[model samples]
Target: MAKQWLNKVLELGEVKGGLAWGRFLFDGNRWVTLMEQAPKGKLVGTDYHGNRYFENEGDIYTRKRFVIYAEKRTNAYNPTSVPPEWHAWLNYINDYEPTTFDYKPPVYALKAEVTATGTPKGAWADPDKRNWLKYSAWAPPSSGARGGKA
Candidate 1:
């Protein structure tokens, strides 16, 4: 009864918005406590991005499934930022969850935002030079040259 009421209330948007509030509702006792009542599987693992993954065998409403919940970080939401590994798991590539399996992010993978002043060695910097001459028409060779051919 309480769970049903909570669900109805959330559907009405009474819980509130924003990252902090959403986090509190989804991860806090308000939501988790209710979710616990429902049939849920084990939590596989969380990525550097703070997205949690979960799975369970065939349930009443659906078959083996994958679930993800975003973190409550200050940064605004960006669905495209999800890493490939997590994407594969979400799409059902393997039965085993990444958290349980041996998963390591590649060394070259982008980890964080780049600072403006800190241009680490080997990093490519824009020369800022433009090839505007290419767009214009070609010009003939100079007359002063010693070339015999026109």
Candidate 2:
């Protein structure tokens, strides 16, 4: 029993060491995001996407920049969520925030695949697959107008 306890204690110490050195991005799956505790940097500004940008000029050798997402669940956060301007700052592309730069988001053409029954369609369906005559919008010629013709 003593040996087992000692092993567990040693494992815990290793985990602590890894966290202190920033080896892992997560911190016990808490509500806080990883970037919130990223390098101790100054809060520069927030981007349009609500991502907070930070920069630390503490020392020439250790200067760093990071971002903490505003998403409630940070674990599912993706780096792509950061806009181009903030992305530039995070990557040190420019010394200043890309305020005046014009950024056009890429447009994507998306189409729905699921059928009315909620089952995913394995193959694409033809738009004109159904017969339209049965559901035609124009009403049949009036019998009186045609002198009671069929």
Candidate 3:
């Protein structure tokens, strides 16, 4: 009940002119409201996706570091949005936190996979011909480009 009231007050205060007050109030119990408790260690860093990571000595609630996924815009729950790096940190592959460590993502790994060009052709466009050559026909040469005789 108290937490709900605090959330409402924080929201109202934000709508008003007290921006910092609202932020502080909202951030004060963010871990509790979101993750249901204070983070065990320091908040290391936040990704572009808004997911925050934390780290501390191995203890209860976690054997190593752990992460909290960012709440959706509508505050709905979804776990698939968590990025890979934070996921590794959460699983305790490295002791150093993301904020302190120099993170270098693999060049190819960071690149997005692109699908093959062109949409699927409908029945009106062309019939499926498995053995047909897909190349386009070449245009006839222009007189100007060929330097033709006058």
| Candidate 1 residue lDDT tens string, 31-122 | 54235422345556777766555555545433345434353333323455456777677676655566667767689977643234533343
Model 1: what TM-score?
Answer: 0.39
- For model 3, residues 57-92, the per-residue Cα lDDT tens digits are 555645445455555222233455555656666766
**Candidate 3: RMSD over Cα atoms?**
13.6
Error of 1 at 41 (Å): 3.3
lDDT for each of the candidates?
A: 0.52, 0.51, 0.52
Q: Each candidate's TM vs. the true structure?
A: 0.39, 0.40, 0.42
Candidate 2 at residue 67, lDDT?
Answer: 64
Error of 1 at 7 (Å): 12
Poorly placed runs, candidate 2 (over 4 Å):
1-39, 59-63, 99-150
Lowest-sum lDDT 10-residue window in model 3: 111-120
Model 3 regions more than 4 Å off: 1-36, 39-41, 56-58, 61-64, 73-75, 111-150
- Least accurate stretch of 10 residues (summed lDDT) in model 2? 30-39
lDDT of 3: 0.52
Per-residue lDDT value at 34 in model 1: 30
Better of 2 and 3 by lDDT: 3
List model 2 lDDT by residue over 111-145, tens digit each.
32222442233323332354435354878876678
